[model samples]
Target: MAIAPQWEAALQAVQSPPAQRRPGRPRATGHPTDRYEAKRKAILDAAARLFTLRGYEATSVRDISREAGISQATLYHYTGSKPEILAAIHNLMADELLPRMNGILQSDLSPERKLAEYMRAEMELIERHPTYTAAMRHKRWLLPGAAQEMREKRDEADRILDAILQEGIDKGVFHPFNVKFARLAIMGMSNYIGTWFSPVGPSTIPEIADGFARILLQGLLSASPHR
Candidate 1:
């Protein structure tokens, strides 16, 4: 996924090379920055898994340290505090996801296409990173510092969805359904995938996304409602 302008620091940290190695040394396996970023990503992935399985409140720095195969002090060097790690997990996802959703809101696609594409994009993200998705969804209100702005971004997403639904109504592609309720229905249906989606499952993410979209766009009744 293209990096969103919202958070450039992590991407920069990974991309920027650090020229730090003694001339006579054995090259230290790779670039120092690459090593740093790889280790950091591992730490975050470990934390995401633990946060998803053990729950954030029950997990600790020591657990993350052990999971990452590093000392507590070393974990601190990569990620300052537990809260910061949590914030980073959420921030990274937001950086990759929110921009795409925002773009969909402004895309030239028809309303039906927009909603379907939006659902697929979102489900694909969740399917790709189910651990982080579940971890972030759990205790979403626990964000600290500037990360609290995530709540605002989430609210903005809500407005974007509402506008898309409104566009469908205005364009005569959909009946004038209650936007709030429709939004809730779709959001609930999409989010539940985090709990049950499996790579080996009978359905792929695109299939699940398309199926859910079809259910919303077309009623369950294949013919007239049977009384």
Candidate 2:
């Protein structure tokens, strides 16, 4: 997957060295904590890129270390194991979606509007973080605990969507449908976008999101015969 412009800028920024210290006193390398955070972010960026290009199961610690341009020891100092890194990436994807989804759910908007906003947010997320979405699709099976945590977060997101759908049904704004299946259909559609969406494609994220929301709320069948 092509790296987004912002990610490209971030990778370059982290690779650049700190400013030279003044000659008079002692050389400074900035704060140790800042250096550690930069290195950690770099590792995650590399891991997400590699995991997107190569299957997560096939990527090794050595691969990540090399991609990050750090020694194996240095990589280990930041992230202990490959699975741990994968877990972090999974959490990162979840963190990006959860807060926005929760806010939409908690808002005073009507159910249909809430669902539309949620769909837009989700589509935008997939557009911005395709690599993370791809990595999540090919999850590592070895980490059961980590997998369970991710599943729980996913379920919570689904519940919020389901609640909105149910509210729509109750209010007669939407057809009565199985909320669980509706939620699954919406999520499955959004998830599949990672496989084909292009940053430089003709359609923008909002365009895609609007099309999806329209399809979800209105069936594709023509309402009348052609004139």
Candidate 3:
């Protein structure tokens, strides 16, 4: 089966991971004491770089195994395939990111303020781990189980945003729009940052977050201040 050209980049990128951090139930709150987690992270980082530089199909498990200083058997023990590695990378990101978002959602800040915080956190995470961003763009055609799992988690994030937007609309603080579409547009804009935005660039992550929030708050249509 052939993937579309536009989707190919992302499919290969998914061989890396998403730009966002993953969230989940916390097991041990502290960092790993052993070298296992550290080695795993190093492998993932190296794989991300390799996948980005060379197409996924062109990059082999032997390449990652060699780059990570681990044996092919060890790499297989950690992750079965490229897609599985991508899924694991995303799971790691979500585990780091979602808990923070959940905390923000629980805070006393106004809906608008919460949204701004979420955007900032999101952009910062993307800046740190951009491979995840590329993977997300080509998520649809990924290995079925892992891809669906990722989609469900992503939907959870959207639900959080949707709730915030709904709250603002109820309080007459936000412009009314189709909730699903608005959420998609907002998230789509944020998720694509890996393709163009760079953490080392002149424009800082905070600036990008601020700009996105500003656009979300102020639509292109002129508004009446009198209202």
The candidate that wins on lDDT is 2
The list of candidate 1 runs beyond 4 A from truth reads: 1-35, 140-147, 219-227
* TM-score of every candidate: 0.77, 0.80, 0.77
What TM-score should be assigned to candidate 3? 0.77
Q: lDDT scores for all predictions?
A: 0.73, 0.74, 0.68
Q: Which 10-residue window of candidate 1 scores lowest in summed lDDT?
A: 1-10
**Candidate 2 on 1-227: residue-level lDDT in tens?**
34444344433443443333344644559998997777787788788778766677778999888887777897888977988888888887788899999999889887767877898888888766666666676675538999899889988898888888877776677766777888888888887776667666789777887788888778521333121
> lDDT by residue for model 1 over 1-227, one digit each (tens)?
12223223323332322223345535478889999888898888888777766788888999888777777897899988988888878777777878888899999987777887788878888766766776686545465654567787777778888988888777667776788998888888887776566566688878888888788878422233222
lDDT of 1 at 100: 89
Candidate 3 versus truth, CA RMSD in Å, comes to 8.5
Instruction: List the RMSD of every prediction in angstroms.
Output: 9.1, 5.9, 8.5
Q: Model 2, residue 113: displacement in angstroms?
A: 1.9
What's the lDDT of the predicted structure labeled candidate 1?
0.73
